[model samples]
Target: MKENLTDSAYAAGWALVKRLPEPVATRLFDGIADFVWRRRGKSVLRLESNLRRVRPEATDAEITALTRAGMRSYMRYWCESFRMSTWSRERVLASFEPEDVHRLDEAMASGRGAVLALPHMGNWDLAGAWVVVRGMPFTTVAERLKPEKLFDRFVAYREGLGMEVLPLTGGAGTLGKLAQRLRAGGLVCLVGDRDLSASGVPVEFLGEAARMPAGPAALAAQTGAALLPVTLWYDGTPVMKGRVHEEVPAPAEGSKREKVAAMTQAMADVWGEGVRAHPGDWHMLQRFWLADLEPRPEESVLPDPQGVQ
Candidate 1:
């Protein structure tokens, strides 16, 4: 019963929200953000805890201000995603231009595949759309959302925008498919900031030990794809701005295991630089650091990402 409602809500989002006028939609989504922030729900609190790691020196008041802004940014991502399907080719290209995109161009031009590893910041869907409209289709992996129908909705949404979507689970030969795409000089994009799997490589992120997915580094290592770290943020404009940092080359001398670890850590280091610079744009709302997984008595009382969190 609940799952059906959940799926219906998303179906309605795509069907209805995309049709809203710009100012009306903006005010509606912004109001929802402020309401959720005031509630300080679990997601909001977790977001606050993560932001604290990004700025440990901030006083309580500062953290509060930052988290509120973060919520606004996060909500902006959702609003943009719901509305992006209505964007035309010109609008897509005009929005969210990256600096140093020629790095990707060079990789694609060389007939070697490129892996675009981005953190969970800004509007990734919009970024993917921008690439697609530029005539460069890419393959990306998505976490399977609950309620099988809901999963299909998301997959269809992305596919409609020219992406080849693969399930992170139950999609057999996932790595093999990615390698094939690379060998064909295609592009693969992965959200590299979170360790959805327990086996992700460990690294120092934002000055704390966090595990990040090793898939991006491993794919690049095995397929000779360029491992490019891309970071995104939003300014006051409708444009989603970002930078494509130089590629993280595999170490010249290391075992297969060691090479992947070193590459993943280097990627993490690049992520730290971006997250620090655009703390509010980062959309991490779940437990991230290894230490956060440990049991603690005070965990229940943690401030949510809303006003108090």
Candidate 2:
């Protein structure tokens, strides 16, 4: 029963929100963010906790203000997502402003394929859409949302945007499928910041020990693809901004496991820099550090991110 309501809510969001005027929809989502921020719900408090680590020197009042800004940024992501399906190609291209995109071009030109590892700092879906518009349709893995139907909705939505979506679990062969795409000179984008599976490569992130998914690093090492870390953020306008960091190279003379670990740690360091540079745009509103998750080991590990990317 609860699952049905959750699915219906998202269904309504896609159906109705897309039809509203741009300014009206923006104001509506901003209002919703403020309301939730004022309530200081579990999600809000969790965001506060995570932000403290990001800005360790912040005073209480500053943290409070930061959290509110973070909530607004998060709500902006949702607003952009709900209406992305309705966006035209020109709009999609115009909205995303990323630096060093030639890296993607060079990687693909090498015919070894490329893997874009992105943090949940901004609307990654928009970035993906921008890529698709440039004629490079990529494949991505999605963590299955509960109430099965909601997950299906997400898949269809991304597919509609010219992406090939794979399930994170219970797919025909997730790792093999990704490798096949890479060897064919195709692109794969993965959310690298969060580890849905607890068994992940350990790394120090944001000044604490945290586990980050090794898929990006592993895929790059196995297929000889370029491993590029991309961080995104909103720059207080409708335009979304991002950067493509230099690719992480596999360490010389290391076992596959060692190489993966080193690459993942490098990726984590890049992510920490991105988050610090734009803390509010990072939509991390859940437990992230090892110490934070130790006591609540069995809690839901899935991020409250509106889009899995």
- Best candidate according to lDDT: 2
Off by over 4 Å in 1: 294-309
In angstroms, give how far residue 201 of model 1 lies from its true place.
0.3
TM-score of each: 0.94, 0.96
**Model 2, span 156-242: residue lDDT tens:** 988999999998887898889999999899999988787744677889997798888888999999998999999999888889999
| Residue pair clashes in candidate 2 | none
lDDT of 1 by residue, 231-273 (tens): 9998888888999899999899989889999999999999899
Tell me the lDDT of model 1 at 32: 82
Give candidate 2 regions above 4 Å deviation: 294-309
TM-score of predicted model 2? 0.96
Which lDDT value does model 1 have at 113? 91
